[model samples]
Target chain A: MNRVNIVGIIVLIAIAIASPIIAGSFFAPPPAFIGPEFLVQIVAWGLIIGCIYVLLASGLNLIFGVMKVVNFSHGEFMILGGYVSYWVSILVGLDPYLSIFVSMVVIGLVGVLTERVCFRRVLGTSKLNEIILSLGLIYVLQNAMAISWTDKPIQIRSPFEFVTVSFGVVRMGLDWLIVIGVTVLIMAGFYILIKRTEVGRAMRATSQNRSAAMLMGINVERMDMFSFGLGTALAATAGTLLAILAPITPQAGAIPALKAFTIIVLGGLGSTIGAVVGGLVYGLVENSTIVLLGATWKDAIAFAILILVLIIRPTGLFGEKEA
Target chain B: MNILSDLRKGLKTPKIYLPILLLLVCLLIPLFGISPYFIHVLAVTFFYISYSSSWNLLAYSGQASFGHAAFLGIGGYVTTIFTIQTSIPWLGLLLGALVSAFAGILVGLTCVRLREWFLALVTLGFSIIMVALTIELHWLTGGVYGLAVPSLLPSVNHYYYGMLALTVFLVFIIYLITKSKIGLAFVAIRENESEAKATGIDVTKYKLLAFTMSAFFAGLIGAFYAHFISYINYQIFHLDYSFWPIIISVIGGIATIEGPIIGSSLMFCIIEFLRVIRPLVETIDPVIKLNYPKIQVLLMGIILVVVVIKMPKGISPWLRKYLISISK
Candidate 1:
């Protein structure tokens, strides 16, 4: 809204666009013409990952800020979303993209139900109990997925497999472009919903001060559920992307979720913009680490950066200090 | 003159004698011609009980550490490094503990300022980093293949006895710590740190003390574990193992001695039981493929959830309730 904010957004957009081009020049070099198709291929994949992190971290921020509960089971939820997408796609023979909507709605509903039935009761309990309880949920959900779907990896071919775009100098997969486009739309929609809507206002109010919000007739309970539902939906969306990006295994969420935790920390807890920025930073870090160092050391690099960030600035890059 | 008051106080305290009695029963367990496998399981359970209880000492202050296995790795590696090089087994064990406690101090100094979830993340990050370091520094850690430590006890029975003795010693220390005024301070900090600080409780100092104590015992258990297996792999000190003891404490119930004792034993058994299912499935249909390990993990997740939902007070509270009901 302000000049600084506008400038910051522009810089971020520029970086997002430039990173792949720079990466291409260094390693994945194309011909001198550098067609639109080649440009789309690299940028789309990067943005898709960026969007997934955004979804995961934003929900995480909301939960952490409002409930003061770290939902470690978040990765499991995303995996569940992928599973649901698979299930829906198999049953209906519909496009995987359509199944994403189904997964999001189901997960969102599940989130609300869980909040009302479980989390609400544990609201004022000790932090230890809260963590244990969430861990419990994580275990339950993970096992349930295993029971329903076998542990063996399942792959779903993107429907846009048949479609391809050729831009003279390079070619791009249509499915990837669709994933990016959809992700952008969803993220934009989420941003508006959080910043502009009445429900969003209530969420912000509750996150800031629950008791104060309750006194002002904000229905704190409803707000908490709403936030959970939103968070779960976003995670489901991420899961959909993950399903397209990588094959689904029961243990898929384990590593990705752990990485997401680092992003949340580095970006600063409870900040949406921070989640986005952190997600991209993490994505780039992970991608670059893999490129520079072998896969064996990549995990080390990411975690080392996480520990250093925590030691140096625990609040994260974009999180506001709790005054 | 004070007989009634004394009886009431005794009733209010934990039934330590019952567990002590159980320990005696466990001691006689070797007399029965039990399978060597069963003895090994018991020994492993004993190791975890010590490890998880030590973990409780830290969790008691409401700081959930994610890098706990680093201490275990330290203990294991120390035993490995020293036992082959030095003749003194007892000294190596003590040194392992001391080093781990010292490491705890270093970790605490760096990360103790971050409270609650942030602290957990810091420790989690540290644990992952430590695991990476172990693998990366192959000369010291032996990389993924792992290294075998020298065995002090010649027989499995001797190892079992040694583990039992260590468990008893560690449990006693935990008991003493919990019963003391420092344990009360831990509870106060856990309940409300700001209020505790306001009340002149040195929150940081107490937390650091808990961390050091926890690390010392955890390291001892880990070193003992290494001695028992005669091997310490990079896998042993992984983030996965680091998290399990915390889960054991939480599931067993936090800030209680009996909690870890019961939780670790029960979890260890459950893990074994789940593993058994794999063989059963294989026997049922050789052609039918089964990913039992994944299923076992899934079951653990379910067990965690059910425990949280049904028995949030932990297994100790449920056991207490059952015991009291039976008595009544």
Candidate 2:
């Protein structure tokens, strides 16, 4: 791990430890567990949620990094993913984990189609035009879902049987472990793909300069579609996993999308590692605050931190200035 | 021969004659046996005209503010809180305007330093923050349930007249601003910011001035809106409401004095008419439960896409060109 990662991990661990002590002092609590067990649960939730955010932000970062286009509909794509899982589960009576492959494929095609039909035409336009277009698209997709599925929140019941693993003092749901495990698996796979694959090299080249990549025989249009599709598919997958953790609604994607935007900005846009680190930081800040200071201030924390980041370091922690 | 000459000269100044004629027609609508509900819609359309016109003032200077809804919220919330929470209505309006203007100045200072895109992002951030605060600070804002407000006018006609007068006042204000050297300053900033600054234009002051002025009227109208609606909620000041004015200005043709007026009229008509189709369809054909909300959003998206693709200069520019060509 790099120095930043090391520093981030240490700070996160410190926050995890200090949070419960702070919470216990603040409010009357049922003594669920003592020192180590509480600490482990907090860390586990923090890591799992943080990694989910990173998953969301990484896709967003890639889209922004390469195309310099902010997809306002990113959250909706995730919601769409959740809805997909919801339906697939109902139709096949299959496990959500087993359906992930099918969900990704459908959303991947959606990403490609969205890029080709809408975003491709608007490429190279002024940022203002692109922003408005994406926003309009968001309205369209959000309302479409609302119409198709009555705008009510639906719980996608996890197939995981209630199993808790106790590591000395720490004990929690088996589902939580799956979340962390999946996050790690996805992160590792993404890292290898970007670092080791030819497509990843082409993406890097295009992100550096589109015209330059075209001159180097890289198909710029195809690359753009691929990047957008990859980003969008990842967004859907994140949504699907998040559905396992919580309930799903047509409008569920909006808040998560905002959080993802914050993470990407905080980590520095388009930096893959930065997105993951930022996501973890965000998760800790959000979940820890909820644990310690009641659930009322959760959304506020996300935006407040984002504004602070923007004001302090507009370039973000690992951000390169975009053209 | 004298009458013909007079008519010809009058026709030459379409701007002056056209608005006066439209105003006369709007004033006569209540006399035509139209329902009060339709009148309310017209009042809202007028209100949006003022709101979107002020928005165009900022857009003219090339600043797209997402926090515009915050100013509107501030105006509405401040006025309502004072009216309901305390024994004041007029004082609330003034104070709300001041507070909203001050908030605009603060947001402007932070955002005006950035590029247009960053400015939009920051404003969008502020809008979201404002919405969140409205929900979180339920004690003050009444949360998602909304706050009941006292009316500035005693009746719907009173509200209608108030909105009408305000709309006309705002249109004249915007026209005067754009007609002057400041209008040229706005156009300068829009076309090329660096060049405008180098040419001795105080770009920063011009931008800040535009933003503050835009907020001033936006806040003013929002304050009046709270009194007119007699209720204020998070929904009224949500980001969705915030977006309409921007889209209006864009669809109407950004920066033109009459653009927002036309844009607001068109949007209101579209929304109102499209809504009518739902009930009509349900009555005439019972088999289909027409989803109005879905259709409305879908239509708006399609309109936005089609407008950007076909009429990038917006409708007003084209209308003006066509009119001029026909006259020639």
Candidate 3:
């Protein structure tokens, strides 16, 4: 946008790119990096994790855009989706991948219900109320899941668990490929829904201006529910993927949720493309930092980036509104 | 003589005397020869009052922190490390507050310009980062296993009295600040930052002051908590620590002097009641018995949702209004 901003962006990019090199050489030994093989593996891991974040964060961005409400409990819905998929896999004997659709629909309904029941009344109230309400939902949902399913981490064994895919030098698991593929498919569907459909137009219109959209005969209230549901469905999809990737515990959603929030903020509060880019960058940075600094620094690195970004551009990288 | 008369005149009013009466009642709880368990609960109640009041103070300035446990954990760890190193409990407590205040100022500097959700997330991030650092620097912080701290006072009675005294003093100071011009500036900023800035208020200064003060008290209580619990750990930074104050403040009243006290007392009582009746309820209904541990949190969530929807101003103000109407 300006010379100073451009300089800042370039500097940040440089630091991000150089961090792995710095970590490998300066902090820990370079033995962890078996040359380009590890690098490719890290890149692949980053893409998969980044895609999950993209799905999670874009949902958050979508909800924030239309509803102007930041759902702190969105991650719980993701976990709920994971649990639903787990149960569906166990009971219905369907593949976890196939049951993801069921999880999405179920969690989508829960999201809409949550919006109507809890969030609707506090929609235009103080931001504190919305935050508190979501915090309450976090306790409710997490505890509910803990009570029902217990806090023990449950892994959803994917049907493709035994299969592995190799792309040139980089080898990947079939589950990772499927997760990434599903993420791309969902994101593309989201794009079409937003850019091509009438509901998408309504959602976009409402996000642009609520009262104006209301004046134009759009049911802004219903659109709020729809967007919230859709946002949550995306989060649930991420959770379903996460279950396949790793164990899904009740409290497991908190960190990823925080990361998703960081991504949305980094990209811009209401920008879908910003979320995707931010997620990718975050995933890459996080994985690379783990490579360099070990796993302990992984969580801190994302927030450090967030704090740095906020200090430089409080409105976020692509945010339209002033901080 | 004149000041004494003015004080006497102020005490003649029910408003002044009621709180004084309440304070006396609180002090006499230790005198009533209550069981050690009850004393423990009372001490914890006071702890929550102190913590929630500090949280409410920040919220009064229109800055609701989601990760206040950051300050709490900082204070706890600082006090533990300091006292372990120096064996001076009082100095450790003071330094803990100072360190937390300093950290608070840094966080506030980053967050003062951000909006509500961003501020909350950033603060939450800081708490998470603090936890990470604490775990990473296990050589110093004892890692997740946590470090034991010497008690401030050996006896539960002494500890109860200490907490009560601190609570009373801190609450008085917060009361004075909220009633003063600085408090007015805080309210102004909370209501409309631009208007306050236009009116010559340095928005950053007051907001940072609120953050510093809130963190100081939180740290003080955290130091006390470490001593009372006889251990300090990264678990102090848990979300439960953060959420408890919010629950107390929201239930009691937001932006009110009496809110945190009432909220903390009520919540403490409810939690205690649930604990007492849990076994009985379990015997009656095996289903509830299975979920008994989670019921308190579930109820808190439900109450929080109900309060936000039905009584956003909280129960304290509603009680005040109802009482006033009844008297009228």
Model-by-model lDDT, in order?
Answer: 0.75, 0.78, 0.88
Score every model by TM-score.
0.86, 0.90, 0.95
Candidate 1 residue lDDT tens string, B1-328:
3445654676776664587688898899988988888888888888888888888888888788877888888887887888777767778888898998898887787666775666776666666666666776778777878888887888888888889999888988887777778988999998888999999999989999988888888888888888889888877766567767767776787778888888887777787876676566667753334545655666666666666666776788888889988877
Q: Candidate 2's residue-wise lDDT over B1-328, tens digit each?
A: 5545655686887655877789999888888888899889999999889988878888888888865888888899999998887876688877887888888887787766665455666777777778767887888888889898987777777788889999999888887787678988999999888899999999889988888888888888888999998888888767777888878877888778878987887788788887777666667643346466567767777777667656765789888888889867
DockQ of 1: 0.39
Give each model's clash number: 2, 1, 0
CAPRI verdict on model 1?
acceptable
Q: How accurate is candidate 1 locally (lDDT)?
A: 0.75
TM-score of chain B of each: 0.90, 0.91, 0.95
Off by over 4 Å in 2: A1-40, A320-323, B1-11, B135-139, B143-145, B283-290, B325-328
lDDT of 1 at B298: 60
Report iRMS (Å) of candidate 1. Answer: 3.0
Per-residue lDDT for A1-323 in model 1, tens only?
34544454454445434544464465444455535554444444555576787778877777777777778778888998888898889888879988889999999999888888778777776666667677667666776777667677886678777788866655667776787787778889888988899988888888898899999999888888888888888888888888887788866776677677777776666767767876765665555444434355555655666666567655554445651
- Pairs of residues at least 3 apart in sequence or in different chains that clash in candidate 2: A37-A169
User: On a 0 to 1 DockQ scale, where is model 2?
Assistant: 0.43
lDDT of 3 by residue, A1-323 (tens): 45644554455466567766775586567664468988899888988889889999999999999999989998999999999999999999998999989999999999999999989999888999999988888988888988888878899988779898888987889888888899999999999999899999999999999999999999999999999999999998999998999888998887788889988887667877778877877788888888777787788887877887788777776665656
Q: Which stretches of candidate 1 lie over 4 Å from their true place?
A: A1-47, A161-172, A318-323, B1-16, B84-91, B268-300, B321-328
Winner on DockQ between 2 and 3 is: 3
